[model samples]
Target: MSDVFEKVMDLAKRRGFIWPTSECYGAVAGFIDYGPLGAMMKRRVENIWRDFYVIQEGCYEIECPTIAQEAVFIASGHVKGFSDKMCQCPHCKEFLRADHVAEAGGIKNPSTMKNEELAAAIASCTCAACEEVLGTVEVFNFNLMFQTTIGPGSQRVGYLRPETAQGMFVDFSRLLRFYRDKLPFGAVQIGKAYRNEISPRQGMIRLREFTQAEAEIFVHPDEKNHHPSFKRYADYTMPLLTYVQQEKCEEAVPMSMQEAVDKGVIANEYLAYYVALTHHLLVTIGIKPGRLRFRQHLPDERAHYATDCWDAEIRSERFGWVETVGLADRTDYDLKAHAQQSGTPMTVFIQYDEPKKVARRRIIPNMSVLGKQYRNKAKAIFEALANATPTAEGADVEADGEKIHIPADLFEVRDEIVDIRGEDIVPHVIEPSYGIDRMCYAVLEQSYDEDTADGEARTVMRFPPNVAPIQVAVFPLMTRDELDTIAHEIARSLHKAGILAEYDDSGAIGRRYRRQDEIGTPFAITVDYDTKDDQTVTIRDRDSMKQVRIAIDKLPSTVCALLDGSLKFTSLES
Candidate 1:
């Protein structure tokens, strides 16, 4: 960790934002507990995300078990491919990611290298902790899933889920039924996901267990270029770093969503719409617009199943640009894989706008000639040929792992026109995956500020009002009964009005305000001697440190309005 990271973490710990878990027993890496303020702030962030995906998008949310059967991951491809390259130090016996070691040694893009290349790079570099001349470096795949047993004696294998996406895929049939087997319906899941990191560093940026908010929007494969609500976000402009620009070492160019889709910069309208929504969400949650951009994933970097993918990267002082969310056009991969593995159809019946006659191929099988050639198997072959589309010359069919070839005289093929109403199709999925822990860290870092107040350096977190840990803080000018009583009353009133408020009366007014400023409390109400007579209190703004006097009855409404940006502190100057 760098000096800036240490400072931010120190303030977080001191102000009840976060703490290392199991500190008394020598805390482990990659894990931390959210303190009182952090927990409340995290809840608010989750709720805000829910508003965007669930309420605004009209998607239903579902809760699933964090642990799943091994078969679930096998179908999702997480069991085999979800791994990282790692090398254990011969001297210290500590395991570390091989790519990270190569990057520290001035090698760029080590993630795309093969295991042998990563091993060779590790051999040239020394241990990061100890400068020991390492022996031969052997890079190997390290699976990141936490394995467990569902029953006694390990009969049923299970694992802690690596993402919430698989849960949505597994519940496809149920969700399809809920949506009445319609296309373009979505399901979202927010829950804990576990990753067994080889070497977890970077505080909150990397974690063994974290929260993920994932939504899978199932749409017709042919309808990706057109959406019902494309106009809603078509005009929104964002900074886009295309794959071509990355190859040329150029910065992101500002472009509107409509232009991006029209020029084929983005894959389709569905992907572009979510990209714009991600920008809106990040900015609304207090991320600086200048420090955020959408970087398109290169063909080599994207998953095999995804046609196009982009990451919403947030700039951090300590860790350069970090990916907080991933939006991908996963076209019919998960659903098809699960259907093949589970033997349950995962498809939506898409009806045509108008029923019409379609050309059909009919196969007529000769049963009498086949009955004498293969007495028992002829029956199965006749049934198989009935459902198969035979050619004019011949056709091949397989049953019970045996290949059976039918002669040209055995079956006749003819084309005919028939009326068809609809057909079943595997819906393509557009996913927006979010790492809540990383987002929380980005919020903290972006909101952090340092300034001099009254000749002393004061640290403050200028978090947005919607996601602030404490919306308002109530303070007493002094620790007197007359002042403390009014402060508590004001706190209660604010709480009743659905505002999170804290009351402080232990120290001087300056110290109380400083404490709230550090935790990003937007508004502070200080009850002084004047309040007992006039029934008015002084409200201080965290960002400006400006104070305003308002009547007691109007305090709740004023604070609420200020938090929502409807009422400004400068408006009360006159």
Candidate 2:
């Protein structure tokens, strides 16, 4: 591991952020335990995300099971699909993802090749892991999803879901009913998705099981061409790495969201609009705005069914531009697939204002003349013309590229007027899928920093106040009788005000402040001796360490304001 990764691991472990799973005996490769502080931070982050995608956007949130049935996967095309080309080491008997190995080794499309082709590619390349001459790497398709049996006897085969998108697709009909059968509404799901990693060694970056926050927005096919809410993010700047830019420019280009949509880089207004919103939300969640960019997937890398796709890539200290979120225009693929498989209609009844009238074409074959000429085949010709609509060949169209010659005993062909009602349509889907675990790590990496002052360096997590694990750290300066009692009382008061206040009296005031700072607690409230007479406590800022004296009665509003960002520590410092 690199020095920075080691530091991150050490800091995370020491500060109750993250740890390996089942360390009592042996640790699991693809599992992690979120410590007390880490759990709070993660929960707060997810809640804030909900505030944006669910509450603000008027979308409903859904929870689904981790293990899905084989039918669900088959319908979603995950059974035959959802695979990565993998090669196993002969000596160590370890499996490896072909794409990762080829990319790190500076090769291209290693997974797309056949077994023989991949075997040839590997002969020229060496394994970074063992440095042992890597054997012939036969490219075998390996499903990333972890398989499990739903019932007791392993009779029913199920697999842990690879993505949360399928859940939203499966529940489309119910969601449509719940939303009063409206188009252009979204269903969001935030939960765990699993992947069985092969030879995992990227720390928390690549995990077998991770959390995902996914949104499936269904809209009419024509509606996707333009979004009414596009103006909301029109002026926002998004650093874009398009296919053309990647090929031509040395770095990503920063432009308004509207410009990208108009220039055809984003494909449409709806895709661009959400890309900008995602950009704004990421910055709000403590991901550094500079290290973030929306990278468009190339034609070869894009999903076969996607109309357009982009990834929110966060530059990690170690991994260099890792994909944290995916925004794709699925365009009625999932629903269509399910409809075909289940033989059930998954459509909303869109009511039109008025019925339409139009001139129609009808083919009426002349059966009177055919009855005298060829009476045997007269019925067949009449049936064929009645069932046939207008084609290039007019009446009695060709079957299998060959004309079925019939006698003229059928009805005649003519145009007739007809009145038409509304038609049913398959709503296209625009999905914004997020890898929540990766975003959590990005927030940590971006907010992490070291400050040096007074001949010593202090490490602090400069997390946003709302998402910080501990909102306040209550401390007694001397751990004295009066100070300690008042401090505990003050902690209780903060807790009642809905703040995550932690009481620390075992160490010096500075040490207590340091501990709080490590976990990204925004404020430190100190109840000193003067509180006994004047009823005042000192409120210290985490970032600046500036202290302010406030009355006990006013402490709640002051701290609450600080937490809500309505009031700032700098404003109250003086």
Candidate 3:
């Protein structure tokens, strides 16, 4: 870990934000426990995401079981493809990611290499930790899912979900019904997803189990370019690093959503819209705009099922550009896969704006002749023949799970004019997947700051008021009963008004202010001698360290305004 990482983690642990999980037993890597403050901050982050995806985007959220049947992954292709290439070092007897090892040895784009290719690239490399020459490193696939049995004796195989997206895909038929068979509808899931990482050493960046907030917007395949809310982000400009630019190692250039879509840089408006929204969300949560970029995933790096993918990456001092969100255009892959595997119709009936008369081929089955000829199997054969759409030569009919070829005489095809009102289509999905833990880590890393105040070095977390763990801190100027009573009362009043306030009387007023500042408390209320003369207290701003005295009666409203950005701290003092 870097010095900045250590400093931020030290402050995080000391101030009750986060700590390693199960430290009492010498905790293992990649797991963390959010302390009280960290929990509060996490809730704020999740709620903000909900407001954006669920409320503003009008996507209905759903909670699903984390443990799904093996069939779910089998259809989603996770069973066969969700794996990381691994190799074991002969000298150190340690396992490592083959691509990561190859990349560390200065091999470019090692992740795109085949297993045999990756093995050859890293064969001459040495173990990073043991410094021993790695010999005969055979690369193999290591699945990242946590496998388990749903019932006794491993009768029903189950695994923890790798992403929240599959749940939405699996529930497509139900969600379609809920939306009344609408073509452009979305479902979101925010819950725990598990990946049994091979080696998780990057603090909160990689985890065996983490939270994912994923939204799957199912739209008609032909309508991806036509989002009803596209106007909201059409003019929003952000730095976009296209896949072509990435191949040449070029920087991201600023481009508006409309231009990106028109120039075919982005696949569609739906994908570009979510990309912009993710950028806005990251900035709102305190990530510096200059340190953030939307990097388009190269074909070799993107999932095979995804047509286009972009990662919202934040530049961290320790870990470079860390990806926090993924916006992908998964073109009907999920629904079609599940539909084929499960034999469930995962399609939406899209109603056309106007009913149109169209030329069509109609098949008429000869049931009476088939019944007499087929005997006992006649009904099944007739039913199959009736449902079959005939070609010029013949038609394929299915009966009792078996396909049978029916002759031209069994079914007759005729051209007819029919009124077609709608069509059934497997909707394409636009997913904006978030790594909640990584996001929290980024927020903390970016918010961590240090400066000199009153000739003393002080560490401060410059978290935004809306997401900060504590909005206000109440303190008594001195350990006097009169001032303590006033401070406690003021804290109670603030709490009643739905403000998170902390009361401190153990240290000097400056120490109290510093303590609150370190935890990102936006405002601090201190009760002093003047409180006895008149009901008033001093409010100190965490960022500016400026003080303003306001009446006790006006404290709640004034502080509420400050927290919400409706009333500025500077304006209050002036």
Which candidate should be chosen as best, given lDDT against the real structure?
Answer: 1
Task: Identify the candidate with maximal TM-score.
Answer: 3
Model 2, poorest ten-residue lDDT window? 392-401
Better of 2 and 3 by lDDT: 3
Per-residue error (Å), model 2, residue 297: 1.3
Sorted by TM-score, highest first, which candidate order results? 3, 1, 2
Cα displacement (Å) at residue 226, model 2: 2.7
Tens digits of per-residue lDDT, candidate 3, 1-574, equal 4578888988999988888899999987878899999999999999999989888888989999999999999999998788888888887778888888887888899878889988988888878868776767899989999989997787899999999889999988889989887778889999999998877988889998899999999988888999998989999999999999988998889999999999999999999999989988888888889999999999999997898999999998989999999999999998899999999998777778998899976677777877777677777877776667777678888888877787898767778999899888888999999999889998899889999998999989999987899989999888775888888989999999999999989866788888888999989998889888988888999999989989999999998998877998888866
Off by over 4 Å in 3: 84-141, 359-366, 376-416
lDDT of each: 0.90, 0.82, 0.89
lDDT of 2 by residue, 1-574 (tens): 4556677778888888888988898999988899988888889889988999988898889998888898888999887668877777665666777666677767787656776777677765666666666767677788877888877887899999988888988888899889998788999999998988766777788888889999999998888867878888888887788977776755788889889888888988888888988998888888878889899988788886697999999998888999988999999999999888878778876766787787976766665776666576556655566677645444454444446655333445567777667677899988898888788888888778789746779888889888789998888877776789888888898889888889989877778888888878888888777777798889988888789998988888888999888998887765
Off by over 4 Å in 2: 84-141, 359-418
What lDDT would candidate 2 get against the real structure? 0.82
Ranking by lDDT: 1, 3, 2
**lDDT per residue (tens digit) for residues 517-543 in model 1:** 889999889898999889998988898
After superposition on all C-alphas, the RMSD of every candidate to the true structure, in Å, is: 4.8, 5.3, 4.7
Clash totals for all candidate models? 0, 10, 0
